[model samples]
Target: MDQTVSTVIDEDVCIGCGMCVKVCPVGTISMKEGRAAVTGKWSLNCGHCEAVCPVDAVRVMSLDKEQSAFGTFDADHRWLPHGEYDTVQLVRLMSSRRSCRNFKDEPVDRPLLEDLVKIGVTAPSGTNSQRWSFTILPTRHAVIGLAEKVGGFYLRLNRLAEKSWLRFLLRMVGKRDLEDYYHTYYEYVEEGLMEWKQKGRDRLFHGAHAAIVLGSKPGATLPKEDALLAAQNMLLAAHAMGLGTCLIGMAVEAMKRDRSIARFLGIPDKEQTFAIIALGLPDEEYQSTAGRKLVVPRYFEG
Candidate 1:
């Protein structure tokens, strides 16, 4: 394998800003004229320079590896074995799976919904243990009802424990920053409550025509893994079928605290909803990923 790889910076958006050069803790970046250049043959793969740069001008192209590591989609989702998938296409599909908080007030096709679930059923579980179950909220009414119930559960827990000291201590996380962490989701939810109930575009369920609630065995070694895989599969399948899906993280966070949620979702007492996917036919089409903060590695070697 090649010891060093090269990451290129897009000169256009670079703005000749040395943010990348300055932030490179490993001294792996250098200034080239007015542009930022990657140094050391990418011997240091840390991407702090690229991440800190205001303009998205950095590209971390891995050497001796697929150049599409930073982008590209696996259409067939063969990122794993035992499944014939297009690894590149899957990456695109997964990355494109956006958190759609606003959705069209429409219903989903039943057969297509069934097909999506079938795709999830094929996801590998822990040690091949299929301890996963799914509940589909088929109608708009039901989706709202479930979300409302889950939201109530969240507010109650929000008042519970005084505050999370560990997360705060480790990362200087404040309470407000801790709660409603996902892009004004709580505010959106609160505002959408009335509109969703009236079948308006509150998009409380992110405009999902249907939602698949995932359940797993408590204390099961692979519960979270199995549930997440199933959710991913479902999201991709929904995307492939010309539909959209969003994994509702807050729902899972709330459900983990409420033991009765499983029962509410028709899951057996032994099962818990580890994930919930909001699915629906897309109202509009979009390409390209919204700007996202680069995922920076903690440190580097060589």
Candidate 2:
């Protein structure tokens, strides 16, 4: 990649503690006599050298100085004081989170939505590349418009899936890769969507006060994974704020397939919504947690 790493050592400020060498995940830093130096031919560019320096003697040329972590380890500005007790509380909070479909008509305040987005964007990303973007559909009308477009797209797909002759024609025309989506649309048309329509409710968004569309740039490495992490973070934070959240996988899929729906959401042509979270005050409540089958991990010891 022709990327050169510039490492500078302050001879006078260095205490020869060798802390930087020990903390470096990649073996890029080495002790030359009494001072530290970059001995490796290539750097992973993880920025551990600068983080471990006791006296700030090392500087990575490729790193942005403004974005670098500030403050000492003992008094790090980013450290939060919660520990095991907080972990238990967090677990309880997550266990109580429900995928709320029924929402009160009250709108989520702009300040709360802003706070949720702020927490969401702070989620960890590959190489610290926070490329996630969010589009907040705050009004009922806007959210309904998006839901209608996605529902229409699915309805059209359902027609082709329902007719035997049309399905055969579609397969012959080099479009036989939609079996899974076709099934989903078929079920939606048969029962799931009709139930909502009978109750005069929005089938897609479930009459949520607002919907947050989480997206990332097309072709980005780990885009789906990154967006999922951010969505989870937003969910937990929303629950904490006395709000409900539901991940709308159907709407996300429709957005990916239909460019018109994507444009309606104001998402860029090259960007895609990996996930959508509907947020609002809950219309229903649960007194206790429900039981479900658990899948335990298979651990390996080497």
> What 10-residue stretch in candidate 2 is worst by lDDT?
68-77
Q: Candidate 2 residues 1-302, lDDT tens each?
A: 22245666677788888987887756677888887777876665656677777687877776664343322112233436456257778888988888998999988887677677777866777654567889998877778888888878877777767787776787788887565556655875656556656776676787898989998875446788889999999999788889898999888888888888989888889887899998889898998878769989999998
Find the candidate with the highest TM-score and give its number.
2
How do the residues 135-252 of candidate 1 rate in per-residue lDDT, one tens digit apiece? 8888877787777777677455444322556335534544455443433444455555546556555444665668888887654567888888888887776776777778877777
Clashing pairs in 2: none
User: lDDT (0-100) at residue 70 of candidate 1?
Assistant: 20
Model 2 residue-pair collision total = 0
Q: After superposition, how far is residue 42 of candidate 1 from its true place, in Å?
A: 48
TM-score of 1: 0.56
Per-candidate TM-score against the hidden true structure: 0.56, 0.76
Clashes of each: 16, 0
